[model samples]
Target: MLETILKSAFEWRNQLGLLNESEALRIFYGPGESNHPELQHLSADLYKDHLWLTAWKKISSKVLDEACEIMTRILPFKIEAIVLMDRSVVASEAEVVTLRGTSRSGRFAVKEFGVKYLVQMEKTKHPGLFLDHSPLRFWLQQTQKNKTVLNLFSYTGSLSVAAAHGGARKVTTLDLSKHTIEWAKENWANSGFSPEAGDFIYGDTFEWLPKFKKRGEQFDTILCDPPSFSRSKNGVF
Candidate 1:
């Protein structure tokens, strides 16, 4: 089973070049709707030298050993570390399993469509950016021009950066977490954008939405990607 995963990872290595030379890639995604039924609960993503694994259920020690061995044998570069997470647990908490190698405690960058996002592996449940939204980012980069973009529930502001890169006149990012907003600022800076390039709002969307309406503030393009469930002092969304 592990050998099959190794082969798939190796095959997909070249596919990253299709997106960008230096960027994160989903080496394997075997969760729901995956062809590999045996590995239907496993997913792996590669960011620079790091590997992040997530599973719907707890993985056994023997499976972990086999995975480590196969990864070491197939990867051309030195594997810096592997972070494992149980989706059921991490859905509510940010805790993760450091399966192998040294955990990165500082800022790390992951490129996508030439934009760089600064991510902290240990600070949050998500590794700064959501890989599934790469296509949307690419689309925004190609379409936004002289437009105002409003990104609601913007985690680390990856989409906002994309809109800015696409020549949006102004970008506004709103999120509840101050830490994530700061991290988004770092990503903006890393992508050759200044903090002044975009407006970062640290507040609840529900609270702010009505204010935006009352103030008559309108955006040409609005991107709303909220979590399935969220809690705020005023109410839940």
Candidate 2:
């Protein structure tokens, strides 16, 4: 059963672009005889091919990691901001990030000069740093040089800190949960930034967004990363 399953999985993998690069059929099962374990026996020569087994294991591991990295690169950050399952993140600066997972957290500086952003996976659904929104943040930094920025549904306020570093006039954050707001504030402070630069508002975003918009008040720049789906007494937004 195991051998049959493995063979079928390999065939499916080839169909899925996982093993399409190589002619696996020619390499694994030449015209000499059956190379599939399922067509042979448990202790057959095919099963005893230590080199083939080792190669398959290594290649599979590599492919899995590569696939994950590609997916992570494009996957949008979830609107819901929660604690890292067994890890945490600290932004040392606009160009530097530190990720501490269940085992360890380390800092790495990144610049768009010529290097790719270093992504750190953590316990949170989101990795330590969000990369997909790189374009959005870059634009904010350029256009919000001296404008007040409001970041709603701001989990870590990574955007807030980015704006501050980019010389935003002011940054305000509103989140119903106090803990997430505090963490956002902490991240801002960790970069040697001023607490005064940010005002953490603790409340429901739906109530706060409309209220702020109604006060004849508006920020020069606003960055809102709202949950995919949310509900309130007023209605779902």
Candidate 3:
């Protein structure tokens, strides 16, 4: 496992084009007594202060929060916050709400302006984060006023809440899982946005999307984050 982690870190370094290769290598190995003097420059303190464990799911919540703090320090503009949500939706005592449900079972979670601006986890090997799109959230805050926004695959509806904060006229969220939609509603409520401000649709987006299009309806803004692959009640859309 350790060898795999080191290999993964090396691959990550290569992919990211990080300038400090040795420093990253030191983090991958962890602090050891037999380290060289130059490697001594790479201390746990240094790594802990800047490096993030965005992909570590088994890590405890406290450690993940610390990592997110470090990640914000490293890339603040790319992250507004981080959270770890798993099948066990309830964590950190954040108020939870049940929106809808499916035959099989899944859930979503929401947190208020609690603290850290980014979260890391590994429920499905994808962190509960969309840091790559933080810039778009800021865009919404700056431009989306009195406009309706539709968040498809609204996993937790963070965008919907952000739109409401930006004075969106209304928002609609669609997702397959009832638990997630419910969690999104809770998040909207926690953001001090009225539940009525955004309508929650629980079912296949394929069915919903064309229906809205056929109604000659349009959204001021639309956001989509489809899973790498998924199937809907109607067909693969």
- Name the candidate that leads on TM-score: 1
What lDDT is reached at residue 145 by model 1?
A: 95
Tens-digit per-residue lDDT, 1-237, candidate 3: 333433454456457644232211123322342133222222221121223222212334454344334434443133322333232333343322211111111222322222112222223323233544555666777778999999999876767777788889999999987866776777677567776788998988877889998998899999988876566666664
lDDT of 1 by residue, 1-237 (tens): 668766666666665464245467677777633555446778877777888887876667777677766876676678888888777555767477788888799888877777787766665576877878888999999999999999999989999999999999899999998888888788788888776769999999888999999999999999999988887787776
In model 2, the Cα lDDT at residue 227 comes to 71
**lDDT values, one for every candidate:** 0.79, 0.47, 0.51
The candidate with the higher lDDT, 2 or 3, is 3
Q: TM-score winner between 1 and 2, please give it.
A: 1
Candidate 3, clashing residue pairs? 80-117, 81-117, 81-118, 82-117, 82-118, 82-119, 83-119, 99-182, 100-178, 101-178
> Which residues of candidate 1, in runs, are more than 4 Å off?
9-16, 19-22, 32-38, 90-94
- RMSD of each candidate? 2.3, 15.6, 12.5
- Give TM-scores for every candidate, taking all chains together and pairing residue i with residue i: 0.89, 0.50, 0.51
Q: Candidate 2 regions off by >4 Å?
A: 1-102, 105-123, 230-237
**Candidate 1 lDDT:** 0.79
- lDDT, candidate 2, residue 236? 75
Q: Give the C-alpha miss distance for residue 207 in model 2, angstroms.
A: 0.7
In angstroms, give how far residue 41 of model 1 lies from its true place. Answer: 1.0
Put down candidate 2 lDDT per residue, 141-219, tens digits, no spaces. Answer: 5677788988988766667777777788889988766766776766676667787778888778877878887897789
